[model samples]
Target chain A: MRTDLLRRVEDRLRSLLAAERDLWSGVHEGAVVPIDALAELIASGGKRIRPAFCVTGYLAAGGDPDDPGIVSAGAALEMLHLSALVHDDVLDDSGTRRGVPTVHTKYTQLHGSRGWQGESRRYGEGVALLVGDLALVYSGELMAEAPRSVVPEWNRLRSEVMIGQYMDVHAAAEFSVDPRTSRLIARIKSGRYTIHRPLVVGASAAGRGDLAPAFEEYGEAVGEAFQLRDDLLDAFGDSADTGKPTGLDFTQHKMTPLLGWAMQRDEHIQALITEPGHTPDEVRRRLLETGVPDDVERHIGGLVERGCKAIADAPVDEVWRTELADMARRVAYRTS
Target chain B: MRTDLLRRVEDRLRSLLAAERDLWSGVHEGAVVPIDALAELIASGGKRIRPAFCVTGYLAAGGDPDDPGIVSAGAALEMLHLSALVHDDVLDDSGTRRGVPTVHTKYTQLHGSRGWQGESRRYGEGVALLVGDLALVYSGELMAEAPRSVVPEWNRLRSEVMIGQYMDVHAAAEFSVDPRTSRLIARIKSGRYTIHRPLVVGASAAGRGDLAPAFEEYGEAVGEAFQLRDDLLDAFGDSADTGKPTGLDFTQHKMTPLLGWAMQRDEHIQALITEPGHTPDEVRRRLLETGVPDDVERHIGGLVERGCKAIADAPVDEVWRTELADMARRVAYRTS
Candidate 1:
């Protein structure tokens, strides 16, 4: 059932992007590249985890599992995720995403191939930025089609994610390594948007606004676990499994809970954080010696168990409660 | 009356930004910087011409002059313009705007002063990009408050400007200096959003959707003249008068109609276009020798005349017809 819902969301995204491409192709040929870039980025593989969570939340709140509206709303969440990814790549100077060349990288290559004037880097970044903005606008357009009752939640979700991103980026730039700050970033950045808001938005769309508080509690637990898993994957997961090169958090000296824990264990670890010219293997080896990943895994297990308990206690249908619990486990233990 | 309306728009912007700042300050102190950056950028001076045009358009279509909705919608246009300016400064690597330091520059300075760890330039640019995105979201939020009937036009206006920007950037990158491409870029980039869409959106909000065709003709003529005036200011106006350094168009090899005219007069100017390391004075001297500025002035005169004539012929109230004609003249002949 989850796979089928994911397929529907994919279909909805493709059709929406196709219509946008057609509309802009009539405007100017140059306008088509950005749209095409967005479409390509979306076509690259993702777990569609956010959309799945949204669908499950809707189902738990008594929304029709087969409703096209629910699927469309889920697609909007996915599009919003893509928008963030495109901009995040630009921020990270990432060369690829999801095992494919990122939007900026692709545009940079296009600039070089065409022997374009001005700095190719500038042109590429400009195109990528505009493409990201376009994706954001399209996301809003899709959400505008959802039930009006969900509009405030949609806006809140957008604002929270952006604010969380600012906090995350600012902390890294400032070299802030406190565990409290790290956890705060995780809660606002991933915990809320990834799980809490989606559940609330889904519930609101299902005319189950009353269920939001309960879902928020459940979402907070699951979302924290989700981010913890993500941090672990960034540290130790295989490129083949995660579709991302490992140890980026270490290289960037990202202020993750794992990093904070490692720093506490050995003050020498501070020098390694965002240390210039450190190889990923060396950083990973040093971090592993601190046992931070194991500590994070234990925390993830506790949070997943807490989330399952929340779902069990939620005032939801028994079937959906069971499904939600299953989902919490899957999210907690997923390899990718 | 126009000055009073401009003041009201400014007041509206201040209140809105203040509310946003307060809301985010509660989220995380770090998130407040972007909001503050946006507020500072907006507080710096602008002509507020877009809002004026919107108001004029609303009144011409018989909308209530005292309605807060018109002012709110007009504020949305200004916010959208702010978003574009913030992003444009990042793309151009501009140091200042309106005789004040640009947002990225201010943030860069902050990073330096605070002795932050990461590359200051990267931090500044990232903050600016996210701030621009925030402003864009705020623009949409304001528009969502406008009458639902105008939502489609709002979407079109946003999409057209973004597409126009892509075209402009693409031409600059590809070194495409054709007159046709330049005009097309101007029409979509500035002409539509600046005058055409505001006029249409204001009219639609006033329940005068029937007047769209006539407003489009008037708006197109005026908006072209407005952009031409801007190109002239970029090339020839004093920094004190224009609040920006002169000859940016020449320095950047911006594909303006004036550049097209110069290329027509002296094909050798093509080599000089986007020539690296040439001083702005040298490029200005070469372009002036081509007499393109004078030709552009003549073109601006014709467009202003045509716009005024369209306003005269439009099927709106006679009183507003005269007022709009006067506006076209002011837009065409402005020094700054």
Candidate 2:
């Protein structure tokens, strides 16, 4: 049932883009560029983790399998993620995403090669800005098809993500925010936004608002695990599998929780990050020597356990509980 | 009646920001920065044209003046405009808006003064990007409170504006996209988006979708007049009254319709614009000497008459038609 609905979610996205492409193509040949950018990113594979959780949440809450609103809610989550990623890439100055040149990078190069009138950097980033804005708008359009009851949760989810992102950017610049700020950002961004709110959005679509409390607990635990895994992946994972350049958090001086721990153990890590001529390799070795990686691994294990416990008595079927447990393990352990 | 509704619109905006300020203040000290930036812009002042058109359309369509949804819808239009302005300032690299420093400029200076970790330009623009994103989300939240039937027009209005912006940016970069393309953008951006759609959204909120055709005819005519008047104002108006620097269009080499007309008469004007060392005074002199400004003024007069005529026989009361006619004249002949 989940698979069928997920397939429809993909269909919904494709059809929406197709319709837009047709609508704009009649206006001007260049009118479809932003739409094309969005479609290409959607075509390029993403884990669709938000959609997966949303779907699983709906079904687990006894949502009818045939309801199309679930599909729309799921698709809206993915579209919003695309919007965030596109803008986030600009914020991070990331050149590549999902093994492809980023929207900004591609267009910036286009401007330069074409000898466009304005600064190529501005033109490129400007295009990315509008594209992201369009995706953000499209996400709202897709969610409009969902049940009206999903409105409150969806609204909270979006505003929370934007606020969390703002805080993240501000904290990275200050570079001296307390570790508690790092944890709070992690929970706001990863735990609540990526997991908890999506699950509740799905549950609400299925007429199951009662599932919110349990979903929040489960989401917060699993979300932190997911984020910890992300930090570890960025530090220790492979670029080939992840499809993005690793160690960006390091180069950008992002104050990840893992980095926070390493800095606490050894102050030199800060100079290595903030100053020039130091490689990511040097920072990696020093982090390992701090024994924080081992501690992080153990903490991730405890988090997964806690996440599973959250859903154990969530008024769901045994099958769903077991499935949720397995999903938590996958989220906590699997690499990008 | 309109005054009462407009007052409610202001209250809605202030109270909404106050609520958001309180909500995020509890989270972190710095979390309220973006929300505050938005509030400052709203409080600074704008023409509130879109909201005025929306309220007018609703009242003319016989929508209940007591309907809280109209206030929400009016607030949403203004919020969306604020989002566009914040982002537009970044794209244009403009220093001031409404007599205050643009959000990006203020934050960029903050980053520089504080000796923050990242590039000052990136930090400031990133802040603006997210601040604009928040406003976009907030607009959606506001619109959700209106009648559900406004969805389709609302969707089309948003996507069209984004695409229109993308085209505008692209046109500004390529420095040439044919006269027809410029007109299309002007119509898409000013006519359909600023006037027609807002009016239709108002009518839709009042359950009067059938009024869209007349609104479109009137909006397109008046919107074009508005854009032309804007061009002339940028070229000739005083900075003190507009609360921003004048002649930005000439400095930025924007392919406005007025510039298009001027270039057609004297090709030297193009060189004066695209190259440095030539002042806006020189460009303005050449533009006026070509006598295109006179023609544009005459064209604007024709447009206002046409706009009023489009709604002369609509089912609305005679008072509304007169009020709309007065609005058209005010928009076309405004000094600022």
Candidate 3:
């Protein structure tokens, strides 16, 4: 029954995106080509995980399965998430996303083909940026037009997630970031946006605001566990399974959970990392040689075990526990 | 009275931005450096035209000056405009904005000083993007949290402005863009955002919805005039006064009104423009030599003269006519 509900939500989200894309039909003659290309690329490759969580959480809280309002709101969250990803790729100079050429890359290719000097990169970044802005605008419109009961929570979720994104970016750039600061960044950047806020939005839409706190706690634990698990995968998983380049964190200079843990390791491993210009591949290999992968994998194992225990221990309805268990089975245990 | 009202709006805007800036405190090692830097850069530079329009339109519609709700809504619009500008500069690869180094450039310089190659640009773009997102989020939050009476109109204005931005970006890229398409883009991108919607919000706040249509029409005409005048300045204005390198449009290949008009000029001018490898300066000089400048200047002169006549002929209120008159004086007779 829960699977059926998630499927329906996915369908609704696809429909909403399709409707919005149609609005760009009359965009200026030269601009429509790239805009349409980017939008289609985004729509084609989305995992729609955020929207699905929003919908499932709503349903788990007894939301009406047929509620068009809830569906539209959930879709808006998905679109916003997609917008964030599109802009992020441009900022990161990422060439590929979700096993496809990124919007910027595609647009850049067109620009190059047209023989317009320096235009390829400009077109890519410009169009992607505009599309992201469009997503944000539409997200608000969807929330505002939602059934009145759901508007308050939807707006709150949107604002909080944006604030959290700001905190995440700000925190990442600091050198001597404290543990508490890091944790706060973690909570706002990944914990709240990925789980807590989505859960609350869903619950509120379902008129189950009373369950919000419990869901928040559940989301926190699960979210932390998810990040930890992802950190482990970054080091240990096969390239195909992760669909990401191996040693990506080391290359990008990203300080993930595994790296943070390794930074706290006994002196030898720490010295190798502190070495300037050390390739991410070299760091990953060194960590592997030091038997650090096993240690980190054990840590991830512990986080998942603990996260599940906490979800199980929560004083919530059996329905929520069951749904969470299912989620853990799908998310924490899966290879992909 | 109008000047006093503008002062009130400006003060309110500063306070709101300050409060919003405070929200980032302690999130980044007890120093909100990046967010503060970006926000300060944005806050200090903008003209606050949107907020002025909101305030004046409200007053024209008999709005109460002391209503905190209108003030908040007006401030929110200004922030939204700021957010758009920050992102737009990044998108445009503009090095300086309002006579200051752009956020991306500042970050790049800082990164270079720190010997952080390439990372600084990424860091700057990432932080600036997040900052823009934050402003956008807060803009909605401000309106959403406004007293319920003005909420609907605020929502409408936000939607219109955002949709208009999308349309504007789309229109700017098109090749076969007709005059009507150009006019529509001007209306949505500049007219509605800069004037019409602000007026609607003001009128709605003042319980004078009847004035919205006139405001919309007036805004459309004036906004087109504004964009057309901008094109003229780009083509012919002094570099010192405009703060842009003269002939930048030809270099950037921007489809401006001057170039658009020149495209339809006699065969002599068309031949010069199609010359291969001509430097932007050479192109500008050649076009001017072909008497394109006289034609463009005459065209602009005609626009200003006709624009004033149209505004005078319209049945708008006295305040609106006075505002249009001021704009005409600025556009028609200003040396700058």
Candidate 4:
């Protein structure tokens, strides 16, 4: 059933992207570059975790799995995710994503190869920015066709992610390692949008707005677990598995909860992070010796336990409750 | 009456921004930085031409001027403009806007003063990008509160502007100075959103969707005139008067209609634009010698005349016809 729903989401996304490409192609020959970039980015696959969560929420709330609205809304969630990823690549100066050149990198190469007249970097960044904005606009356009009750949640999801992104960037700049700030950023940036809002929006679309509070609690737990696991993966996961280099958070000196906890206990680690002279391997070794990743894994386990309990307590069907529990375990323990 | 409506729009904007600020303050102490930056940008003040056009459209379509929906929709348009401005500053590498430091510049200063860890410029640009995304989300949130009939137009307006921005950047990079592309970019990037869509949105909110075709024609003409005047001002208008440095278009070698005309007529002008060695003053002098600004002014006059004629021919109240004509004249002939 999950695979069927994921397949539906993939199909819906492809069709929507095709429509956008067709529209831009009608505008001008060159007008399709950004749209084509977006299509390619979307084609590079993700786990479709958000859409899966959304579909689970919809079905748990008694929505029919066959409803086209569910697929469309799920596709919208993916587009919004793509929008964030495109902008994020530019921010992180990441050369590739999902083992493919990022939108900005692709455009940079295009400019370089064509011997374009402007600074290739600037032109590339500009195109990426516009493409991100276009994807965001398309996300909203898709969600507009979804059930109206979900619109407010959709709007809140968008705003919260952006605000959380600001908080993340701000904290990084300030070199803030406060655990509270780290937790807040994690919850708002990843937790809510990744799990909570998708569940709430999905339930709302199913005409089960009343289920939002329970879903929020469940999602918060699962989402926090998801992020904590991500932090662990960033430190220790295989690049081949994650499709991204490990130790990015450490090298970037991003104040994840794991780092915040480690910093509180180790002055050497704090100096390494604050001074920015240490290599990722050195930091990762010291961090492992300090047992921070172990602590994060323990926290993820606890959160997964809590999430499973929340799902059990939620006013949803037994079958969906089981599925939700399975999803929580996968999210908390996935290698990627 | 126009002044009263404009005042109302301003007040609406202030209160909405205040609400956002208040919301972020509750989220986290540091979360308010981007929101505050946004408030400062909005307070810096634009001419509010888009809002005015929206109000005029509402009044022309027999909508109640006092309807709160009009004010909210106008605020949405303004927020969207702010979104574009923030992103534009990043794309243009502009240090200032409206005589104040741009968001990225201000944030960069903040990063510098605090001796933050990462590169100040990257941090600043990241914050600006997130802030722009937030503003775009807020724009959609506000428009969602507007009358439902205008939603499709609102979506189109957002997508068109972003698509147009891509075209502008692409043309600059590819050194494509085709007049047709320039005009299309002008219409899509500035004209439609600035005048046409606002008018259509206002009218649609008033249950006058049938009038969109006529309003679009009028808006296209006025908007083209407005952009052409902007190009001329970029060459000839005083920095003190325009609140921006002149000759930016020429220095950037952006494919404006004025540049398009000059390039077609003069090899020296084309070389100066395509090659980056010449100074802004040199380009401006050479462009003036070619009489391109005069030709642009003449084009603006023709467009303004056509716009006024469009308004006169439309099936709307005569009072609005007179007011719109006045607007067309003001937009076409303004020095700043």
lDDT of 3 at B140: 71
Which of candidates 2 and 3 reaches a greater TM-score? 2
Can you rank all candidates by lDDT, best first?
A: 2, 4, 1, 3
- Chain A TM-score, structure 4: 0.96
lDDT of 4 by residue, A20-43 (tens): 789888889988887888888877
> Among all windows of ten consecutive residues in candidate 2 chain B, which has the lowest summed lDDT?
B173-182
User: Which whole-number lDDT from 0 to 100 does residue A54 have in model 4?
Assistant: 88
lDDT of 3 by residue, B1-336 (tens): 657766666676666556645765634433355446546765555566677777777777777787777777777788788678777766656776666777777766766687643367667776667667767776776666445555566655554554555444443444332556556555566666776677677777778777776676666655655666666666667767754455555554455555655665644443344446666565667567667667655655665565556556544567776775676446444444
Winner by DockQ between candidate 4 and candidate 1: 4
Please provide, for model 4 over B218-249, each residue's C-alpha lDDT reduced to its tens digit, 9 standing for 90 to 100.
89999999998888888778888876667778
Interface RMSD of each: 1.3, 0.6, 4.1, 1.3
Q: Which 10 consecutive positions of candidate 3 chain B have the poorest summed lDDT?
A: B168-177
If the candidates were sorted by their TM-score against the true structure, best first, what order would they fall in?
A: 2, 4, 1, 3
lDDT value, residue A49 of candidate 3: 59
DockQ for candidate 2: 0.89
TM-score of chain B of each: 0.95, 0.99, 0.81, 0.96
lDDT of 2 by residue, B38-76 (tens): 999999999999999999999999999999999999999
Give me the overall lDDT of model 2. 0.93
**Between candidates 1 and 3, which one is better according to lDDT?**
1
Clashing pairs in 3: A30-B174
TM-score of each: 0.95, 0.99, 0.84, 0.97
